[model samples]
Target: MAEKIFMKGCEAVAETAVRAGCRFFAGYPITPQNDVPEYFARRMPEVNGVFIQGESEVASSNMAYGAAAAGVRSMTSSSSCGISLKSEAISWMAGANLPVVIANFQRGGPGIGTIQPAQQDYLQATHASGNGGFRMLVLSPMNLQEAVDMTWQAFELADKYSKPVMLLMDGFTGTMMEPVELPEPLSEEEVAAIRASKTWAARGKHGGPQHKVMCGPGLDTRISQEQMNERDAELYESWKTTEVEYEDYMTGDAEIVLTAYGITGRIAKSAVKLLRAEGIRAGLIRPKKVYPFPDAAYEKLPLEKLRGIVSAEMSIPAQFAEDVERVVHGRTRIVTALSSGGEVLDRAAILDAARSLMK
Candidate 1:
């Protein structure tokens, strides 16, 4: 068995990224995620990789963009507001078909609401990460182990799809500590092979004149831009079939279901156990990938026996609920157990919501 190490979530993510063959990391300091870049700064040098603490989030995101365009496995991370600053660069990378990994340790937001953890960024992550209507595969981890695993694999997913892949973590997950068995580091030869596979990279020519051009929206002419968009649309569609992931816990005989992602999802699971003990017959459905949401999970629900689904999240006005509503399609009632402005969701609220639905 691989040895387990107790590590903070953010640091675990950083170490996992390094082991996964990421060679470049650029990011600025932000609460709940400062540990990620700090760990990278120390660890990247040991692996002969590069790490830069840019003057600003925008600069850092662009630095990651440049590295990714040059065929380096690159990454960047930030908190909620910092992610907002980096969105333009994310959009540019998407337009140019550059593969990069990004981590968002979410805090409260619309503006700089608070430094405390919140799931308010769900809509921003899955629907509108940037100016252009582009989508990225958004992975929401419920614990440190999943965070480490997702961070390790995010690079490959980004490269496979030729788009940015986001690790959408709330601040709670970023700062929390747990024992996790990290994945094995990629061998040096394996890393080199992966880098060599990117023939379209902006690296200098091997034996002939270079022909690859990395250009974003305005750089491409109208027809080419349209074609690029069409191609990207197809790639996004493919994820629904190949990448959708979710957890259906005790849902077989459930009369009430709780739906959430990230930290809130973890909490909801606890509420499920309590409800089950109380003979309430409640269950939980947690989406692991929020972008290519596990719509099939919702579709397969025993709607005939279900009383309602409680959309529990640490966001006011219910951001995650929107996706649940779209999938449920009025087949059954849907309610929300929400907290915002950095407030965390509690089991009591979820229990009350479920019990009310039962009533």
Candidate 2:
């Protein structure tokens, strides 16, 4: 039997990254996610992998980019502010088709708003993460166990698509501790095999031939840039068909359903149960994959049965609510139950909203 270990969500992510064959990690300390780098700084060395605490988030992102270009399973992580600093590198990585794992343990933020958990970065995570209109596979894990699982899968998805993959969560998810049965760690041989398979990895040519890995605007030529953009667009569209994940909880028989992600999704799930106990037919459409937005899941909902769709998140003006609105497409009235500035949405608040909407 797999032994369940009690671990903080942040530490679980770091440990799982290593187990997934990640050998290079660079990050700076940021509140709500500091334990990620802290764990990597200690564990990476033990595994004979490299860990660097860059002077700034920008530097950390570039360092991760370089490591990934060399075909190492590499990653960087930060809060929303730090992610903004890393944006340029992220855009560059996407252009280069570099596979890298990134995590955003978001905090309240327009500009350093608060350090407590909040889902204020929904727009940043899903719609416009970086320049050049690049899209990433964004996974928002609701619990420590899911965090571990998602972090483990992130490396594979990043490599498979040759693009950055984000593990998006909040401070509450990052700092919370829970019992989890982590997956088995990859062996040294297994890690080496994975690394060796990347034919483009930066190994010296022994003075024979040199290869170039370019991620710029492509030789300053219109044709080159156009070709690059088209290829990127194709990949982005492919994700819509290939990568979408969500959970449907009693939605089959529901009249009121809630939509949420990350920590807020967990809260909404609890709210669904509370409503159920009170004889309300509430359900939840909790998205595990935020980007590729899980639109198909929304389309699959029993629209004829739904009375209302409530978006439960912790953001002002409700960033994710915009996507939910688009998905619902005027089929039913949409509403929001939001808790901002580090506040968790009260379960009762969500329950009451669903009840009132049904009435």
Candidate 3:
């Protein structure tokens, strides 16, 4: 019987993954994200699943790689430092088209960043961690429920594309305790549906031709190039379906739109409520799907009358603001309000930006 439960978001991720029939969990413990692995370790054995606390984040990621190659639903979890170590393995898994789930419970910075939550890893999670060319399907979770729901769905998405999906949650959401209505466990038929498309997975033959899921290692360069193009096209198409999750409050006729997502969006929503109460005619644009960003969302916006778009981000240089600028298409001016070094944005700062825009 599926029911509401009080649990930390990280704990919910483990519960949800298990509910989705995940059979393998491999990860190195790193603060903020450690609860996820610990939960799996505690519960996985009950379901006859395997949860291994690897030697290191590097090993954890590779273990997931090996499990995915063996045709099992596997996952790994880490924060910034651990995520950095998963880079090479992530690249190899992508090249091999292995289906796996990895989560970056993002904490601040470049080297040994703090355990405090930060959105600074935006470039890392979306931009292939370290490698320059590859793209990863990065899903940003705003609340505990999204963390749990997206963790389960990540496996399905990964399996569908035969790629790795990162469920990016901040330290706040991961550690925050919340009550969520967890979905029911999938039926055996549903499990078979996931396995059916996994013909490319390394499952034993069922009286069918031999199967293979490999990288570009063919002697024929032309054929290898074609396959590479196909993978890129598929990744792009996947991005097209990405989303931004947010709730709009009283944005019907406002000229200046405040765009924020994730935890920042939650705070922005609060700002919206306060501003509305103060007789400020401000509207909010919250993007729930940050990647494959909700481009269609813009069609509903009034661009011409816009004074300027204020991008409220948890990091400096306005990581998301740049993307917002691209989608705005010069239809309006763009300004950014940032909280550097993984700092939280001041609510008054955002409200002031809105007040200034109206001037």
Candidate 4:
């Protein structure tokens, strides 16, 4: 078995990014996610990588953008409001088709609501991450191990698609500690080869044509922009078929199903076991990747046999429920167990919602 090391969630993500060959990290300090930059500060130097604590979230995000443009595996992290500050740069990275990994250690929202964990940014992450209609592969890990694994994979996926990828976790998950077997660090030669592969990056001329890194279709005319949008749309659609990931736990004979992601989904797994002990036939469908949401999980469900599908999340007004409703299409009743402003979703609330559906 691989040896495991106990590590905090944020620090694990930072270390994993370094192992994945990320040579540039630029981020501003924010609650919950500050540990990410802190770890990178100490570790990046040892790895001969660059770590910049930019003056602000906006500056840090754009700095990562610049690094990624030069073919470096780059990353940035922030909390909810800080993420908002980085949105414009994120969109630019998307528009430019740069591969950059982003980590959002989500916290209570609307406007610096609190420094506590919350899934209030689901809509922002999946729907309107930026001004553009571009989409990102959003990975939501249920635990620190998954967080480390996903952070490593985020860089690969970002490079694979030439687009930004997001690791979306709440402050609860970011602050938690767990034992994880991290992936091996990339060798210096391997990192060099990866950078060499990015011929499109603006890395100066190497006895060839100079590369130009343009952002957002390069001020193209309306017709040209439309063409670019269509091409980007196809790329986004491809992710649904190739990147959708979720866990279907005890869902085979379930009458009550709980749907969630990230930390809330982790808790919901326990709720499923409790509900099963009580003979409720409860199960869980936890999306590992929320953007190209595991819609097929819902599509494959025996909707008629299910009494209710509970959308459990740490958000007010139940943002995740919107995706559930969209996928289920009213074929079965949908409910929610929600808490916001730093409050977490408890098993009792999920149980109450599922039991009410039984009534």
What is the Å distance of residue 120 in model 2 from its true position? 0.6
Model 1 regions more than 4 Å off? 221-223
* Tens-digit per-residue lDDT, 263-308, candidate 4: 9999899999998898899989999999898889999999977898
Query: What are the Cα lDDT values of the candidates?
Result: 0.91, 0.89, 0.77, 0.91
Compute each candidate's TM-score over C-alphas.
0.97, 0.96, 0.90, 0.98
- Global fold similarity of model 2 (TM-score): 0.96
For 1-359, candidate 1 gives per-residue lDDT tens digits of 89999999999999999999999999998897999999998999898999999999999999999998888899999999999999999999899989999999999888987999999889999999998899999999999999998998798899898899999998999999999999999987888898889988977666766467787766866447778788888988988999998999999889999999999999999999999899999889999999898999999997756899999999987888999999898899999999988778878999999999978
Candidate 3 lDDT (Cα, 0 to 1): 0.77
For candidate 4, give the lDDT: 0.91
In model 2, where is the ten-residue run with the lowest total lDDT? 214-223
Worst 10 residues of 4 by lDDT: 214-223
Q: How many pairs of residues in model 1 come into backbone collision?
A: 0
Q: How well does candidate 3 score on lDDT at residue 7? A: 89
Worst 10 residues of 1 by lDDT: 217-226
